[model samples]
Target: MTDQKSKDPLHGITLEMILTQLVERYGWGEMGRIIRIRCFNNDASIKSSLQFLRRTPWARNKVEALYLWYKRETAG
Candidate 1:
């Protein structure tokens, strides 16, 4: 038998982790500009952003996509 590794880039990563990384790299202002969601645009915090993303699929998708892009950009 052979063992195989997951190819997913976001495997084992949580929503909170993605949000934290984006905020750390871009800050709330840039995230708001990039994503245009109320949670990120108004009084943003990791907790609040997590709540919003958990409930809103579209918004969450945007955030996740941005995170993937961010990771690729900074992977060097």
Candidate 2:
């Protein structure tokens, strides 16, 4: 079989990378507005967001959803 991780989208992708890209594209103040999660709204940073997102699946899904939206919006 091929490299096992090659088929996985989230594999090797750290939550910090996700949050950094999203923050770079939109900034934390606005990202919080978009994602509406306390981690993004409170004293947020890559560390805090990663902690929250890793433990909370629903919030992580929302963050991923926004990342998808950002990808689509910027791709065009």
Number of the top-ranking candidate, with lDDT as the measure: 1
User: What's the lDDT for candidate 2?
Assistant: 0.83
Provide the TM-score for each candidate, comma-separated: 0.91, 0.80
Candidate 2: where is the Cα deviation over 4 Å? 1-12
Off by over 4 Å in 1: none
Tens digits of lDDT, candidate 1, 1-76: 9988989888999999999989998999999998899888889899998998999999999999999998888887
Q: Best candidate per TM-score, number?
A: 1
Model 2, span 1-76: residue lDDT tens = 7755576556687777888999998888998888788877789889888888999999999888887677788889
Residue 68 of candidate 1: its Cα lDDT? 91
Q: What's the CA error at residue 58 for candidate 2, in Å? A: 0.2
